[model samples]
Target: MGRVRTTNKGLPRGLTIKDGRYYHVTTVAPRKWTPLGRDRSQALLAWAKLEGSEPDPSIKTFEVVSLRYEREVIPTKARRTQSDNLKELERLRAVFGRVMIEAIKPHHVRAYLDKRGQQAKARANREKALLSHIINKAREWGYTDAPNPCQGVKGFKEAGRDRYVSDSEFRAVWEKADQTLRDAMDLALLTGQRPADVLKIQRADLHDGALWIVQNKTGAKRAIEVTGELAALIERINARPRERLSAWLIQDDCGKPLGTFAMRSRFDKARTLAEVDFQFRDIRAKAATDTGDLAHSQKLLGHRNREMTEHYVRARIGERVQPLR
Candidate 1:
């Protein structure tokens, strides 16, 4: 028989049986009042075993319910969306400060919702959505018996659709951009493609006076003819000695592949200089939503279903008319 250890709260510390089948107790599970029993303690053990650790299990307790939502869930689903979910989670953890997850109530979530609403509508929605994701994940993973409490909570409403990059803004951005940024922006605009698609384009894909391909975002196969302007852009690019087909065409001086993140600094500076604050993706959406060339724009956008494309156009995009002087 081993010594039965206890916590500061005098609760028996996560107990361990040194029997042939190992049994360990934990209070780390959010909203779980009783300690969890595990035969395989590798996960909790790893945390302890890592360098610069404490002997007490209280270091790992989850009291902040929203923190539990972030840590236990967000990364698993919606992996495609770009967000600093973990960073935001750390902020939550700091605010909650070693509180147990299962110990938290809806009031904690409500406080977060109220504070988030004061910041911005998007901020409120992000917190709420993250909470919903956590709750759903908990239910999915058997952490919670009930469905997520965040399912129907209305935190705030988005005002929406003032974010479009107008035509003059695009032209100004294009004119202001250096060669590297220009080529990068051109691929995004002309192809009506995602930033990743534009950056990852292979030289082999440009042939027959057309930019042909299967789009990675939708997996749709489509082709768009390179008109004289776009063709001229290609000709000038080809005239330069670019990195090999194995490497990305739109690379830095060192020929490293241009990550979307790495180029965003350029986007920020150039858009500011050009006096446009919209995101690069807004350019793609604008191209996709061109009402005059609906069929052609849809093909370029690689929208499999017209309804999906129509919604993206109708709601998210606007005609990029030149700004009135």
Candidate 2:
């Protein structure tokens, strides 16, 4: 009687198409729609499960494994990494959601890279890396026994950023920065820490005649000895008038802890006024290069190896060399 069941004639009862994808329409008074993906075969398998019928043994969708990964594995990563992984997963799901987990091959990954790389090469590389990790996790979770398709597929080569902020450039930005921005800049440069790590610095972290730091990204711990300019800087920070007492070393005018977003907003305004091309993060590289001692810079920057420190201390200006006689 339902108008002779016009479209999708072969579809099972309660399963229908909507907006280019298949959905299972609930039979109850308040109808609920559950997405079963766009592929006919995959959609039918999903409908079979909803109907309490046994699904085919050989068919397991990538969407199934990816959803499981999102529910289980993605939560264990760092906050920023988790955010990035979710975005990458959404993109991957759009292409491979209906494909069988075991059916993905190296060529499929390469094809994805070829297409995605056109828009953002570096971002594509990151997405591919996340996909590789997801597939590996799928294996561990018993979703699929197939080998990772991302393996043997090469990612595009990426060059490290080599923008070195010169002394004049530093001074330009510094002159334009407010007191709060200046404090952040000074701390980042003096401690040779990342912006996130610098923003997390607290009063309790200062002890044992040093400013103790636990890097957010690497979990590396360091105790930068509080002396000379660093000692004076801390004194200056402490002496600043505040309406309310705060534990965080970096606070806004109202004594609220300065967050990365606020700090970045402030930095952007200052950088625009100064007309400088460099970033707030460049201060760390400047610190490493100015230290002039490889070993000392390595320790100061909390790098595990000398080579890693060398990447940060790239010569922005002309390299100094002995003149030929």
Candidate 3:
């Protein structure tokens, strides 16, 4: 015979059937404890009643939640930048595999954040933010009943970065860069495009007086007017030996599409030769930041919000002269 189940004192309580069977009731979590057997199951049920509530999660909870998130959340709706953060989560699971969620206290998260933040201020800051989002979502998914662990940790404090490429730096880079890289660098500065975006430009994207392309990095479609400077650069490249490449204005010497790392390597070497401290992204930031209107700058940068572009601007050309405590 099975135990008779009932709500005791308005709190769901563990009930023992008239038979040797038992049903453990967890009111808070409201999950069932159904173990198969007669006397043995009943004995376990009795023990559960005496203990009250489910046992704490095991150490493997962290890996479990992370797996669920990557499968269910990260792929479907995450943007490009958000996807980058998810990659970081993949990295964390590799080293700290099988850690329990609750077992991970504030100190553990802080230590991880501190170690990574020291490498790249901007990228680390993004991971810190992404970690918070993931943990909060975990709670909502009923994985953990506690608050987000990242909530208690201090995130990476960012130092201001310089984004402006001085005229001398620009000249030096242009003179020293290889043909493909020089075109890319010119396009990056001219259109204020991200390096990832610049490398994807195809010949077909060029039109009368303008370039038309969808920013692959952000999926933002744009048609920027080709100024005389940009046109001149395109003409210069057109005169070069044609590498039967399928990509737009910029391509590898063999005409293979330039990947992000390759493009960056080229740019870094060029910056070094030019003695410039600025990265390719600083061009976009400086162009957007130095402009008069924040709203216009955001649109040009293909950012959805003013705040996103504003920070880049601030990093490069913000009111640094203003006094702050």
Candidate 4:
């Protein structure tokens, strides 16, 4: 037999087992009245054991946990990764804000995924993955004892893009692009680097006829051997008069580095003007195609694995094959 207590409201206090019913009360507001099912005798014994052990802290609402995660966990990621995660968090907070982290069930996760999948399957998939990370963080923080709700939810399959930019298309876009956009495009095309890494380059990165870069995504170091047009572009970029010398190589109309969003919008405008059906990222694949050497392209792009480099470059089947006659 165990001592049973009551609140001032004539309700069970904490986790109580009496009168063949089990009432599990938690600090999570929406989850205040949780029925841990029948089996009163077993509930009493479990409650007694819990009382004798260390006090378990109550779980917070998803909103509170999300704020904490943004403050703590989000900063640990790379800038581009952080930006994408922040967007996912925004959507998650809208749906799961008041829900108790521990009380989130697989059905709720399935429902959310279903709703988001309607708008964009790819976006929904990203959100699902981000949710798993958030749930894992909640578990790590001791906010939830429940298994991750996102674990069994099926993500919508997305088709892989095989859009490769042609050299003539690159030239068309370059011709139509403004000076600032042209500089960024040329750098990306020449180095076969990600737009984020390209924007991070500074005047100091150039030395001994090579562009030294520490990739922000993979943290891999590379010194791209500069020759021909790339070297000439760097020379012209350096010679351009500046109001104030900025550390960033790709400068905006003002002498500061252009932001990711602004650069993307500018590139979109250039694409429209040129009428080219390709993105800035496609330029990396284009660079890979031009090299005609997989290992050289992999090193140039600073991809630690060949698989990732393969994703960037398209295979030239014609070059590898004799006439199939």
Task: Compare the candidates by TM-score and give the number of the best one.
Answer: 2
After superposition, the stretches of candidate 2 with alpha carbons farther than 4 Å from their true spots are 1-59, 315-325
Q: Estimate each model's TM-score.
A: 0.63, 0.79, 0.66, 0.76
lDDT of 3 at 40: 31
Most accurate candidate by lDDT: 2
lDDT: worst 10-residue window of model 4: 4-13
> Ranking under TM-score, best-scoring first?
2, 4, 3, 1
102-220 per-residue lDDT for model 1 (tens digits): 44456777777788677666866775665566555545645556645564566776665545567788888878776778888887877788887788776788778787777655667
Error of 1 at 160 (Å): 2.9
What overall lDDT, based on C-alpha atoms, would model 1 receive against the true structure?
0.61
Count residue pairs with overlapping backbones in model 2.
Answer: 0
lDDT of 3 by residue, 1-325 (tens): 5444342211123534435454554445667665434433234434445666443434336656665555456655425654575567756665454576656666777788778777876676676676677678767867667767777676666666765766677778778788887777777776777777777788888887688867766678778887778788888877788657555667766767877788788878887877777777776765675566788777677888877776777766556575685
Residues 261-286, candidate 2: write the lDDT tens digits: 89999999998999998988888888
lDDT of each: 0.61, 0.83, 0.66, 0.77
Where does model 3 exceed 4 Å of error?
1-60, 77-83, 94-96, 114-126, 207-209, 216-219, 289-296, 303-311, 314-325
Q: Score residue 213 of candidate 4 by CA lDDT.
A: 94
Error of 2 at 23 (Å): 21
